[model samples]
Target: MTILITGANRGIGQALAELYQDRGETVIGTHRAPDAGHLRELDVTDPSSHAALAERLGDTSLELLVCNAGVNLDQGQALDDGYPPAMWEDCFAANVTGVFLTIQSFLPHLRRSDAPKIAIIGSQLGSQTIASGGGYIYCASKAAVLNLGRNLAVDLAPEGFAVGVYHPGWVRTDMGGDRADISMQESAQGLAARFTALNPETTGCFETWDGQAHAY
Candidate 1:
């Protein structure tokens, strides 16, 4: 299968891309850094970047597209301490709007595939039903991505596409920090398994890497 992943220079995204590559799958890994040796340059927040990415991967029908690029505003203070609007904006732009733009740009290529699947990496903290309410900006952005995936699943089902929202658990990456519970390899493996198991009938569901349904 041919797969495309965003923010693939490091962390979970890098691990996922490497995992797919090891399985003999063609991987188009994107990152903002030009020096990202094996990854293509892409900045999801930029429209031009999306266009360029589409051109770069021209005519390659993708079986899977993983929207793994994300950012968390470390506004560690309480929301009452005046939430950093700039951080919120950046988080939303990267985590939510970026997903929309990436999907829009790549939809045509994805349509050409016989089994197209899109998976957006979300967070368990985004679950409204299970939310304890911290990291407000990041939580809100992830929640938006979850809904985006759901809506996309509904809209794309007629075209034989499947969309899923997944939480990678607290992985030990730069974003997850050193205190996280799981390793990046473990998270990527779990996510890959979920991606492989998804079907049109299971679209619109939020799940974890381990196959458990997430609280919406």
Candidate 2:
């Protein structure tokens, strides 16, 4: 299977790429940085870049497309600091709009495949049931993607496609920091398994690393 992962030059995306490669799958990893050892250049926030990537892969079939590229622009900002307006813009641009654009740009490639799946990397913080606030922008962005993924599942289901939203767990990555609970390996492995299990029946499911269906 051929898989495309965004922001795969580092963090959980990097680990996921490595895992898929080791499994003998063709992994196309994208990065915005030219020298970031990416297999291709893609800035998820840029529509032009997505178009360029679509042109580059003209007719190649893509079995899986993981929308893992995201940003937590308001990471450590205090409520007193008041979430900057620009930070919210940047966060949603990468975390929400980016995911949608990537999937839209790659639809043709996915349609060419026998089995196509879209895996969105969302967050547990996005769960309305678990209102663990703090990072408001991150939570909002993730929640939006979760909604997007769920709606995509509904729209794509009749077309023999699967769309799943996943929580990679609080992993020790650049975004998650060293204090996170899980390692990249664990999260990547669990996510890979979850992705494999995703089908039309589970298309609209919001699941965690360990395969637990999470509350939205």
Angstrom error of the Cα, residue 14, model 2: value is 0.5
> Measured by C-alpha RMSD in angstroms, how accurate is candidate 1?
1.2
User: Model 1: what TM-score?
Assistant: 0.96
Query: Which segments of candidate 2 are over 4 A away from where they belong?
Result: 35-38
For 55-110, candidate 2 gives per-residue lDDT tens digits of 99989999999999998888778898779999999999999999999999999999
What is the per-residue lDDT of model 1 for residues 54-158, given as tens digits with 9 covering 90 to 100?
987788898899999988875575856756778888889999999999999999899999989999999888888877757778888888898899999999999
Compute each candidate's TM-score over C-alphas.
Answer: 0.96, 0.97
Compared with the true structure, model 2 gives a TM-score of 0.97
Error of 1 at 210 (Å): 0.8
